[model samples]
Target: MANTKEIQNRIKSIKDTQKITNAMYMISSSKLKKARTDLENTEPYFYTLQVALARMLRHVPEMEHLYFDSREGIKEEDRRRGYLVITADKGMAGAYNHNVIKIAEQELAAHPNSELYVVGQVGRHYFAKKGVPIDIHFQYTAQNPSLHRARVIADKMLENYENGDIDEVYIIYTNMKSSVVVEPQMIQLLPMKRTDFAGVPADVFHEEITMEPSPKAVLDRIVPNCVMGYIYGALVESFCSEQNSRMMAMDSATKSAKEMLDDLNIKYNRARQAAITQEITEIAGGARAQRDRS
Candidate 1:
């Protein structure tokens, strides 16, 4: 049995830890809220663009765009694939980064000749430590997913796709449906599929919509925006997922620490009670001995 002072210190330490975890939980909750709001604001425009692209694809069934075309059996350089992996810059968000990196590793195993573009410091460090080759290491974009960073990623991905450096590109990140529901997923970005656009259902709009100039011309303009939107959406979703996971993890930690503090308090009370009882016993013994001696 530990002394009262030791138990008191333990209680204090746990209480301090609980306070830290609670603060982290609140911060993560705020960040997740902001990220979700940003994502919601962009969804309307992103979905509209998808619908328009779907309509375009329906009208131009035989259209041949590089993004729409597959380069399967091209040269060695053209056969190479690229992976744009997004992860948090820091850890303590449970398995958020770990799950993404694990999926990315599985994808890499499938595409052995692929190039890696690591987006977060966590990923950069992880892949580097894992002895995987990294083509690009973006140290800051994972922490702050901005339009400028999205455009930069878009430009690089487009440039490589056009130059036949990479036949296809994929993005791996965590998808957040709710504060308690977050999972890692990988999405192919290049070689845009008909299904990639506006998520239109088959029964929704069978009627063909008119394209202003030419179907090819309109596709040329909208495809880049659609691709950028996809990348941006992934960034936003991954960020929200990170915050959500962090919030939940911190909340759990806070609860666990509180429970621990309670246990320590119980133990502290027991030890103090034992000490008080012993002192009382000693006083009673002294009083009896003195009375008998007198």
Candidate 2:
């Protein structure tokens, strides 16, 4: 029903939007590939860390250390908890940020004494506007996951745990199961259980292995490195999920824009045809009037 010019303008606007969406999709694909490559490159180191931890635990099955302490003496309701929540720095991704924020809210509701340590700008801004107290000193961007950044975060978390600031530490992040499937997940980071390493096969050796200073001392050094590896893995996984979600969202947008363009083209053709028919009718009427007057 609208004029051809207006429809043409609308078509142009949609075409521009489609270009932007297509560009975003391609960018997200690149990011996702890079993230996966980083993760793959770092996998062996973390796997080795896990194996070392398992071996150490096998050597001293009855050892009691700060890292393995479950803090059973502390009351559940009174114990302070820290949650490291990973979200997106920016969001055009459909429900990626929303899902993470929802899970974080649920966690906070369950644990009223928990402190929120958010990694993304989106999450930080949302929590701030809602008056939810976020750790002011724990500032970090969620754009790119790096080993150095993960190490810094891990050290801070371990320091707080050592200082009795937080009784428990947990990481909330998204895991990309596949290109199209992603789910938000939470895992305990501190006070690790021995059973967690049960699945990892302990090195089999006939000789009795003896640690240099003490098993506890060696474990103390290895545990922090292992913790850093875990944090790094979580960061990488979350980053990949964000990229995957963004890719899907942008792809959908581009397709929808194409559909709109198709429909609009049909309408434009109809409008143009209708205008030409009207002009022909008007010309015929004028000629008929002239003939009648003569």
Candidate 3:
């Protein structure tokens, strides 16, 4: 058993660490709440955008647009692909970053010709160190998932698609199903199929509504906005998942620290009592010897 002083020092160190873990938990909780609120506030606008796009597709099933090009003529194996991967800027979040990176690695293995567009420092550095080529590393956007950031990403993707740099685009991100459940998911962003909009509420208007200029012209405007909304939604979901994971990890760490403190306190008390008992015995022995000598 260690001396009382050493035990006391250990207890103090553990207490300090516990304070840091508790603080991290509280911070993560706040971020999680704010992320969810922001997503809720913007959901209605995105829903409306989706409905409009769905209605347009229904109005003209044969509509051909650059965004809808399936590129079926190109071989799947040979077609150039782009993946927008969302990860965390920092990691203390248990397996959150690891899970995302694993999925991204699987995707790249399947699509050897794919280009990576990573949006977090963690993922960017990991892939860069592994010698995996990154087409774009969006800095500072991972921590702050704002509309402006989403718009910039969407525009860049659309420009690349228009230029035929990539035949297809996909987004890989983490989705928070609930506070306790998070899963990494991937969704196709380009070459959208009409069936993808099947979830949009059935057309409310039965009569033909004439688009001002032309259906194609209207679609051109709505498609990019709709794409931006999709990217924003992904960003928000991934951000929420990261926060929730961090909160859980910190909470667990704080609890473990508390347990250690409790065990150390018991040891400290025992050591203190043993020392006092030894001192009392020594004093009693000295008095008994003095009396015998006298």
Q: Write the per-residue lDDT of candidate 1 for residues 1-294, one digit (tens) a residue.
A: 999999888888888888898998899888878877887888888688787788778777778888887865676543688899999989999999999999989988877889999888899999899899899876588767877788789889989998889888899988886657897888888988876554575436666577768777888788888788888999989998888888888988988998888888889899999999999999999999999999
Badly placed stretches (over 4 Å) of model 1 are 75-78, 195-214, 291-294
Pairs in clash, predicted candidate 2: none
Candidate 3 residues 59-93, lDDT tens each? 88887988898988999889999999999999999
Q: How do the residues 1-294 of candidate 2 rate in per-residue lDDT, one tens digit apiece? A: 999999999999999999999999999899889989999999998888898788778778999999888889999899999999999899998899999899999999999998899998899999999999998434565787898999899999999999989999999999999888999999999989899998997556434678879888998888899889988888888888998999999999999999999999999999999999999999999999999999
Ranking by lDDT: 3, 2, 1
Best by lDDT: 3
- Measured on C-alpha atoms, candidate 3 has an lDDT of 0.92
lDDT of each: 0.85, 0.90, 0.92
Candidate 3 residue spans exceeding 4 A from truth: none
Ranked by TM-score from best down, the candidates are 2, 3, 1
